[model samples]
Target: MDFVDLEPEIPDSIQVSRDIVYKETDQRSLKLDIYKDEFLVEPAPVIIFIHGGSWTTGGKEDYLIYCLAYAQKGYVTASLSYRFSQEAIFPAAVEDIICGIRWIKAHASEYGIDSSKVALVGGSAGGHLAMLAAYTADESYFASGCDENAVSTAVQAIVNIYGPSDLTTDFAVAQGATPKFMGATYDVNPDIYKVASPITYITPDDPPTLTLHGTIDKIVPITQSDFLDKALITNDVIHEYHRLKGWSHTMDASVPVNEYAQKVMTRFFNEWLNGDD
Candidate 1:
């Protein structure tokens, strides 16, 4: 396939809204950006993008290109901000993501969004949070501080890009990033690491998932996705995995890799979120 431009201008057909607060914490306010077609006659499926920064950096703007591109394809798109690991640890980012989903569902009508067809897409640390939020939708542990308790955080689909899945793995344990984010050494609090792992909660009833990982990704290690794929297979979850060759972490930043990912994601989303149940 030909290389795609990473800096395309958003067309006028899509409407953009920036910095809308989704949740409030004593420390700061969490916000998100929404993009959608201005004249949709029916509710469109939603895709919420989370950014990657090893849980301590990046922001909602990190996925601007994806948001705009998907909005042009008729899906309501959003990118959200969450508490970084520097400010809060473990479930804090996951909680913020759940709250963002709830906020999107709560305002679904205004944005012409189909609340039942929501999808979570994230890269690296964001991907980890996306899977955690989607997998634990029925669990109440992470729902404690969320405002819209009645609204479900459940998603119909998920797209994880080079995200770490098993935090208890030896690679994760060896990585200082994991320890910093969890606020404890793996030995000191193995239980918390297990709980924070997305693969820990897989089941047959979980949403359809799509995973993309670079084979040579050293930052998060491709084995993370390998373990996730194995878990999903064991649970009989509907899923697809793309192991890109000769690529490293954040390969999507490369124009060709991003193009390939967009095409795969478009097909995956169409099959899972837009297709008949």
Candidate 2:
């Protein structure tokens, strides 16, 4: 497949990200910004995107270019901002996403989106949340929102773009890799680490999924995705996976090395989001 870079352009459709605070400690405005393709004759399905920064240092801005790109394709795309471990801890970020999903559902008509067909796409730490959002104990949510229905935030499909799937590995820890969201090893803080991992809640009921990782990725390690993929197979979940060669922890998104990953992830989301696969 021939891959091309997305062009830059300011969008014309209405846009907004509602600020919803899931916790008092996570006092910052956890917002979900929506980008529209148009004020259509009929609303379209939504793709809620969560950005990557190892879960500690990402923002909606990192996804602005992406938001515009997806919106141009007729999907009501949203990018969110969640609190990091520095401000809070595990489950808080997950809860933040739950709140954002609810907010989207509540106002779907305003944005011309179908509340029943939302899909999730997250990178890195955000990927962990997307996985948990679909497979976790449906009732494990904080119960801090309008939807008393615990399963309302369930996404139809999930796209984990190089997220750490399994949290029990020791490679990153043994190598003394720079601490990201799960800063220290589980031995250092077992309880918190366990709570942050998505594998703790995986089940056969998880939605269809798409996963991509660099073979040379060392930051979170491709083994995490391997373990998750194995579990998905054991449980019989529908999924797709892609591994890019010669690609390391991505440094320049504009470089030729990461071009393949970019193309694959977009296609995965397109097929899942558009229901063409």
Full-model lDDT for every candidate:
0.90, 0.68
Error of 1 at 213 (Å): 0.5
TM-score of each: 0.96, 0.83
- For candidate 1, the 10 contiguous residues with the lowest summed lDDT are 1-10
**Model 1: runs farther than 4 Å from truth?**
1-8, 275-277
Model 1, range 152-216, lDDT digits (tens) per residue?
A: 88899999999999999999999888998999999999999999999989999999999999999
Give the candidate number with the greatest lDDT. Answer: 1
- RMSD (CA, Å), each prediction: 2.1, 3.8
Tens-digit lDDT string for candidate 2 (148-225): 344377778888877876665666445432234555666777666566667766778788888877788878688888
Q: What is the lDDT of residue 149 in candidate 1?
A: 72
Q: Relative to the unseen true structure, what is the C-alpha lDDT of residue 254 in candidate 2, on a scale of 0 to 100?
A: 46
